[model samples]
Target: MNDSAAPVPIVPVILCGGSGTRLWPRSRKTRPKPFLPLVGESTLFEATLARCDAAAGFAPPVVVTGAAHLDLVEAQLNGCKGAGTIVEPEGKNTAAAIALAALRLPADAIMLVCPSDHYIADVDTFRETARKAADLAARGWLVTFGITPTGPETGFGYIRRGEAIGVASGWRVDRFVEKPDRARAQAFLDDGGYFWNGGLFAFRAGTFLEELAAHRPALAETVARAVRAGHAEGGRFHPDAQAFAAIQSESVDYAVMENTAKAAVVPASMGWSDIGNWQALHEALEKDGSGNSIAGRAELRDCSNVLVQSDGPRVSVIGASNLIVVVDGDEVLVCTPEGAQDVGKLSGASRQ
Candidate 1:
């Protein structure tokens, strides 16, 4: 195996679903986090497309998103070359989304799965990691990128890297741990084998489908039926609404990765952040000398570790630290960084 040979390009499977409810007010049902330009000039979704451009040994991405976001997804992909989209009738989580992509692509095609709403500050490292993951995938390994943990963060799941797989830059996954308590998270960091599960994966289309069939036959069969009954329209593949809607929803971590023996991980540090909440968004963005991030019509005075974003009004924050203030349309949210996690719970209460 000559490692210096031109490697095959992997198909990018961009999962474009998510309500972004955690960053409520700004992130609404109609306009989710991926479509918002939270950190940079381009929307996160656009940034994702750019990240997997053709020059990086990647095929044009296959975006899996719900019908509700079809227009927005298409709009963002305006100038993107060679990209295809699969429009789901309803959201069925990552398992179904990846199945749809796998079923559409050639069996031997390698798929690079990524969530649409993550922020990666280092593009070069990200591409290098993906390339390594693709190398493992080419050899029939179900590969997931294990982000080197910079801190003991409890919000994301952790992956324990086991013995090396005899590859240059790959390892067998010891185990997948769910989001842990603060104590457990610190233990993982101290033990130095665990990496943050960034939800990025690489595998051959046929390999993943086979593993899915072996682990969750019902889901695999149902999604296959839906894809078979699907049709292409205006560059978008539409899975049969009725059949897809009936398929059971599950995450890939639950359906395949945990159950498969071929699971491998490529560890890398690329400044990844899910941007799950306002606090995370604050941390990902650039901050002023006073440690404040202000967007739109916002003014901060004597503020440290504060984030203020206003889309509809002039927001002024003074003498505040460790706070998140957002004003969008008729809604306003003001909370400490610690309380940002509870913001999504407000959505349910408002409906009640």
Candidate 2:
């Protein structure tokens, strides 16, 4: 479908709620990885704004984030060319979060929902894939981007592909597979019919709500109230928090996509990374001969395949291998790379 002939209004929804507990000390409740200047001078949020494809009818993205980060979210987007910002009263997960945006957008518009904290080095490929997804979405199909898995990654969920909808095109979601263990992940790599679930989705507004209402009525009803109550000004919506909180917390995957039959995955390689934890960050960052990555200000000696960051005085690491070290004002995090996923649990325990 020529986008010019029959244009699809694409609205970008940026989900920016995760605590970044795995990267704690630097990524905190008040400031998460999305807000932190990780990759460069610009925060991840700003990079996401820069990545929007306005020519493809993608309007300024609507950022779905917690109220606490409202100030940060607005600040990052303030100078951005084409981006909108909205805050949720609480973290109600993706289903309610997305519903709020869909309700506020034009009924005829299609949306491309993205997470704010991810890192994509190849912006061109990302934008191109998004445009393709938008084309599919315009055709009344709920489209999702499926990352071509490079290796056995236990960190991400997997999607099984079905009969093709086009040549190198739409694929029916065989099922939403859970994050597998190392053995299962390796098998998925060897089997060759699986792709990493990137979480990016494109679909029509009314169609999504229709499916949500039919499959997950409770969630649909609750989100509907919030979406209806939401007020939009220049494409930004301020939903009623009290009402939104009434909705149960759930991910879009669970509330709709998993249940709906129209779900399709657009298999593409966009160099995607959720950056959920330090290990993921380490994997995504550029590495040196010693296999060590340094962010902020740090010095490493005899380190291999390790990540270290310092926000204070010049830091030094010696004889550390496959570890993560982060130093912030009052917090210091050091852990083995394999155990980095447990950092969230450790941080939660420390709070107690």
Candidate 3:
């Protein structure tokens, strides 16, 4: 058992889908959350790229995004070099998206699958977590980063940690649990062995495809055929449209992680957030003394725990608490933090 810290480059597989409607008005179909500079000056996607760009231990990223957002994705590259883009004909969830990336890389290459829209404030801690996961990946364990839970967060799923795997800092995944109710979430926090499933994963390309094929044979076969027939256009690999459409859609958690025996987790405290809604985005952003987060031209008076964002026209909130107000182009949204989850559903109502 030799323990060594060798420099091994990990290929980043960025999943760039989702309309992010819960972040509505600002995160629209035309320009979704990843493309927008939501948190800081640079967009979340660009930040993700920067996180994985190291002198050693990280190769250029292989971004997996929809064909429709190809131009947007390319524009945001910001001079960052990449392995290439794997353009999906349509959204087929993460399982297939990851499979496309796994097929593109060398079998032994370690791939770090990250969602483009997530916000990680502490880049140093995140890189450390990636190194830990990579170590586990090199040892043939499929690794998922278990974010140290900040609170009883019901919005995210949880992973139960099992026994430590030999001398490695990683632990075997005892079980994968779905998002729970408030009481259950609190119980999980009290139990102390559970970590928030941040959806960040690391695995060798061959290991991931092997497990994916073992569980989803037809999907594996179809995606492989799609990859084999795929064509490259301007540094982007376009999977066979018809073939990709034929495969069933499923997330990596459902198709592989939940079922694989090699599932492992590396607990990390990286100040991470998926930014699934405006409330999440608000939490990730800097707040004033009054606990109010104001972005762009916004004025606030007697407000606490409030978030205001505007891209066109000025936004003003007075005598409000726990409210989210956003203005983007022709759309304006006003909702409580509790009501943020339903914003995605509102997009359809607006269309109707």
Candidate 4:
């Protein structure tokens, strides 16, 4: 990147879609994971907003969320001045959500598409990295933040680095790997050429829309129509319900990046985590020498890497490792680390 190049205007596009079923009892459809204080005192959604503040040379953020969660969205965005919310009639996955925000902003605006519920420990590094991504996006490349892998994590997709582009370790994407088996993930870690697909993205609105129209013509047109028929009041913009519902669900990765010749990746090691499940959340919180972290009421003896969380009742654990115990309302969850991945499949996770 040319240090002398002028900076482009960046508008953060926050996608708040999933109900976060993996978090189970604590996360519900009405009160999703993004709104919950999973990582720290402030909710994840709030942290996301602060990370891309206009003070950091960003324009007001455009948040795309479902209508059912409007109250939570409004509540969290209360103190954020100039932030705009694009209300979707229903959840349509990342592609449509991003398209909605892209179409709503000025064509030249650089849209920083960020998931509302991810955790980043180092805010400064994230801001700096985001700026770098913006620089790439302004140059007509679709950019994604490539998180330095801490381990052979099977939960995330991986991006293979191609030839270097721009400056400071940016790469033309060679290929995207789906969540691989343990052996493949280990091989990727050993190769030292793959980065976890962190889901953060950057691109010019016009460029993204053009690519989406070319690759996902039908979805692109319907989203454009939804935006055209949409109405805005104050900070909230509501897309046409019928039009939005008519659009087929798709993710931005499949709809554009995978097919576009402009794909690029930026490597970053800024202490990021999805905080996706109890086990993952346990890793983020402060832990004792025994490798145990407790919230609310809990007790552990001879335990290693055990997470105990309760909304009310006290719990006790002895002689256990890699265990998760959670109590929320009428539901209580107990499982091993491996079992954590399937928490979303439980009957309680789907309850409204």
Candidate 5:
């Protein structure tokens, strides 16, 4: 290692608390989406940890997850020494989930909040930009990674970037726009100044709480109380269930980022994907000339843009276009790419 001042150690507060409803059948209550290897050999959760290794200037991760998924979290940790897991009694959305992690670290600790199941193809680019975000966070900026939009994707919210701040320090977030219709999304894309909000963020632990207290005081206070009353056993910390459950379910985006004056964004084209549904996963995975990607044994004939993921028996498709078929030993799901968004609504998605 070169003899130089080490970079700030960013504590990666990995928010591992999503049902991944849209990715169901394969993603279920027992082994949600993050724990499954949807994109690559290692699971999305494992890939997330690798992205913030010590070499990348990240501190040990603090994983905030629901109690139901604690076993999966621990099993998948696979000896990531020094990592800590915080178990929430129930699902309370991102705001409370992140607050749980923030409360456990030092007030000055820089927290790099990340969603557990997203796929980032360029790890090097991610690390470089992550450090930049951390520097901005250290300077009291609430930084979010602004992913360069590749298309007019109405499925995600967009971030409007403004004047550059600091020396190569990222741009001021002009405003955040909610998910728009296809036409509006296309208009935003054509304007050439918007980016997809990938839900990745960086801010000091204390800075975050201060803003939360300012914008959502009730939530801030309740989370704090939950932490104070909570207890820890070994590597897992259990927050006061009743106190945590009392807090309203809201995303950090609404609770702070959209309300804070310190919001900044680092634009990155790091091959990012939320892997939100079957269609998105198909796009992320490698495809044959016919536009078909298969994870397990699958045979397709005269198929165009088909995705087949089977963890059990071989799947076969013929004369299909823009389709998604999934088979996970216990369940089977089939739908058109457009119909993929409602996969979670199926009764089987909730089953173990």
Candidate 6:
């Protein structure tokens, strides 16, 4: 990367089609965390847009969501500036989602693929890292952001950083590690040089598609056909149901990033959270004197560590600790924060 090269045009692609079953009640199929106003006054999707808007080298974002969530997506993006929305007819995973966006966008466009549901503190630092990543990505390296690990978190995957490229310590991806057990997670933290994979990527549309073709040919073919069949401008941009159904469902990590040779990790210290569960949400939010974070109308007397979100209904926790109390419109969830890993057990059994 030349020191004097002009800044590249980064087309932000927000992936907002998660079901978020673990964060049930508050986070449902139709109303996921991305649509929920959890951390701030605005929804996660809105904050994502705002971040992109504030960042340099960013063009209007291209949102890839489901056909069902079109209204919600539009609603969250209401006050914010306009951007393109590509609705999928079915859930074909991140590979299809990104492919659709890359196809709809121009060939030479530098795309920053991000999840809409993530919580990223320190937007300025994020923007600076993104600008640097954009510069590297323009030179043909598929750049991925690796969040500085705060602790031995078993819930999130790890990216093993390898070899320095420049002043940025551009590391070759040693491997993409899965969510570890506590002992393994602690080992990873102790070993150092490992960062939590935040799933944010920066790359050129054409180059990414080329790598996709080389690695997962079937996926590339299917996505290519789907994009070819997608509705054009001034028309519906949703993928064909039959075509999308024919494609296999897989994440971008498994589909391309993990397999590509040119993959690199940008080690960053940005505070990020996937907000995978309610406990994670509680940890992310601000707490009171008693280490309690209450939303809506709630009160806590002797609660040491607890989170409550109600809908104007008075909730009083006198002696609760390390608990999550969430009251959605039709349902309420009260569970110990430690049991949050199996938080989806109820929903899974209910489906059965």
RMSD of 3: 1.8
lDDT of 1 by residue, 71-128 (tens): 8999999967888999999989999999999999999898999999999999999999
C-alpha TM-scores of all predictions? 0.96, 0.92, 0.96, 0.97, 0.95, 0.94
89-177 in candidate 6: lDDT tens per residue?
88888888899888887777889999999998888888888877887787777899989998999889999988876765477788999
lDDT of each: 0.91, 0.81, 0.89, 0.90, 0.90, 0.83
Off by over 4 Å in 5: 1-7, 350-352
lDDT of 5 by residue, 152-194 (tens): 9989999999998858559999999999999999999999989
Candidate 4 lDDT, 105-194, residue by residue in tens:
888899999999999999999998998888888888899999999999999999999998845448899999999988999999999999
What ranges in model 6 sit over 4 Å off? Answer: 1-6, 54-57, 79-82, 233-236, 348-352
**Which residue runs of candidate 3 sit more than 4 Å off their true CA positions?**
1-7, 347-352
Per-candidate alpha-carbon RMSD to the true structure: 2.0, 2.5, 1.8, 1.6, 3.1, 2.2
When 1 and 5 are scored with lDDT, the better candidate is 1
- Give me the candidate number with maximum TM-score: 4
Query: Candidate 5 has which clashing residue pairs, if any?
Result: none
lDDT of 2 by residue, 1-352 (tens): 2233266667888888877777776787778889987776788888887788565446867788877888788887876566666778788889888887787777668898988888888888888888777777776777889999999998899999888876536788888899999999999999989999988999888778888898889888887787677676673567777788788888899989898888888877877888878888888888999889887788888879888888886778888888888878767777888788888888442462
lDDT of 3 by residue, 268-333 (tens): 998999999989999999999989998879889999999988886898888999999988877888
Write the number of the candidate with greater TM-score, choosing between 4 and 5: 4
TM-score of 5: 0.95
The Cα RMSD in angstroms, rounded to one decimal, for candidate 5 relative to the true structure is: 3.1
> Candidate 6: lDDT of 330?
64
By summed lDDT, the worst window of 10 consecutive residues in model 2 runs over: 1-10
